[model samples]
Target chain A: GAWLGTAAAPHERPGARRGAEMKKLYGTDAAKIQAMEAALQLSFDRNCDRKQPKYWPVIPLRL
Target chain B: TSISASSKPGADPASLQTEQRARSMMRERFLRCLISMANKKIQFHMYEKVKVDATFGASDIDVLNFQVSDLQTPIGVQTEALIRCQDVISYSFDM
Candidate 1:
């Protein structure tokens, strides 16, 4: 009954939440840090897409 | 995230700003180091005493995965592979 009564907030955006967190963590340099992260992420995504790299060892090495 | 612990509750704005700036500087330096590793041969030391070498390609924003080329594993050489950061204990590259 408690689960049915509570509605999930649909207005919250994950990207916006991460931006706010970055601002809180980096203060004035949040934009710069965000930019660098964005660029690195883009490259990683592009390389993975083009190369289709599979995970080595085929299993968790630590766990 | 470690720096957040240093900022005590009810701390002054100036001190909080200083802490945040320090975190930013450290993170920026780390990111720059990753960027410099691109196209360089990196030696990764993993758990279970597994050591491998690969040409660094790119790393995810979260630093959770590293995309590399020509990964030399115990079995054989992998043309391209994605290495989980969790598996890697430490990685080194020449300047």
Candidate 2:
């Protein structure tokens, strides 16, 4: 079977579940990511289609 | 504004003061909760059930807080943390 798009195995720290999710979020629109982080989204998993690993959002949060 | 108890002939000033304070705190906490929920919903889009449960703790700064677990009908979450409102939610009240 094709492992493409599938995240790492369950035992894997960043397994397929996470890998698949990250793929969508690796690179995305900045405005949306800033919005998500502003709302206390401390964690950004692979499924995050907005930003990168740093879910805290280094950028200043705009009100 | 003239409150019922205030106008009452035998209203206890002490108790009324306490009630007023409590009401004020409750209003603050409730508004904070609403904003938090709205921000969470807007941000994650998946956090439609985000909630904020507040309690009057020993200190004004540290209020008891809770949230419904993720995806729970009433906003539920599993965690015991003393969350401060300013710590989260970049809220802007236009109205």
Candidate 3:
């Protein structure tokens, strides 16, 4: 079998190992993340979008 | 006119003012979230088990739609696209 070529194990790649660990951590936090979303999305309903009105009211601007 | 808490009837004026302040803060946080998402690779989960990856641009003020670039769809890669928020079940991205 061609299994003993490298000096180190497969997990020796730091970048790939860190990425895999992050994905696992994120999976466990899914429920907490959903709760956080509920808290943050309270004011973002459909009718909340707004922009400044273009009227005749004048406001001072500092230089 | 903005959607303030004052629209509700039978509510005390002081409490309505407090609620409007909280709502403004929550909205500001959400806007910050949107700003952080700019120019990132996002995975959008649509209906019917469809998932696509794209670079997120800006979303409309109402959040009704999101503008993306280099969207990798099933058919082909679109140079630019607008994804309706109603069609998206969820989206995720790595910081």
Best by DockQ: 1
Off by over 4 Å in 2: A1-63, B1-10, B42-95
Better of 2 and 3 by lDDT: 3
Q: How well is candidate 2 docked (DockQ)?
A: 0.01
In model 1, what lDDT does residue A49 have? 96
lDDT of 1 by residue, A1-63 (tens): 422221121123335436666776678999999999899989999999999999987997987
Residue A55 error, candidate 1, Å: 0.2
lDDT of 2 at A59: 31
Which candidate number has the best lDDT? 1
Q: Which ten residues in a row have the lowest lDDT in candidate 1 chain A?
A: A2-11
Question: Per-residue lDDT for B1-95 in model 1, tens only?
Answer: 34434434124678668767887899899999999999999999999899999999999877779999999999999999999999999999899
Candidate 3 residue runs with Cα over 4 Å from true position: A1-63, B1-10
Which pairs of residues have clashing backbones in candidate 3? none
Q: What lDDT tens digits, residue by residue, belong to model 3 across residues B1-95?
A: 76643343124555545543554456457767886887899998876677889887667545666767678877777766667776778999998
Candidates' lDDT values, in order?
Answer: 0.83, 0.30, 0.54
| Ranking of all candidate structures by their TM-score, best first | 1, 3, 2
Give the range where candidate 2 chain B is weakest over 10 consecutive residues by summed lDDT. B56-65
Poorest stretch of ten by lDDT in candidate 3 chain B: B4-13
In the range B1-95, model 2's lDDT, one tens digit per residue, is 76654322115545534543554455445545544443242122112233333221111212212122222223443222223333344322222
TM per candidate: 0.85, 0.22, 0.54
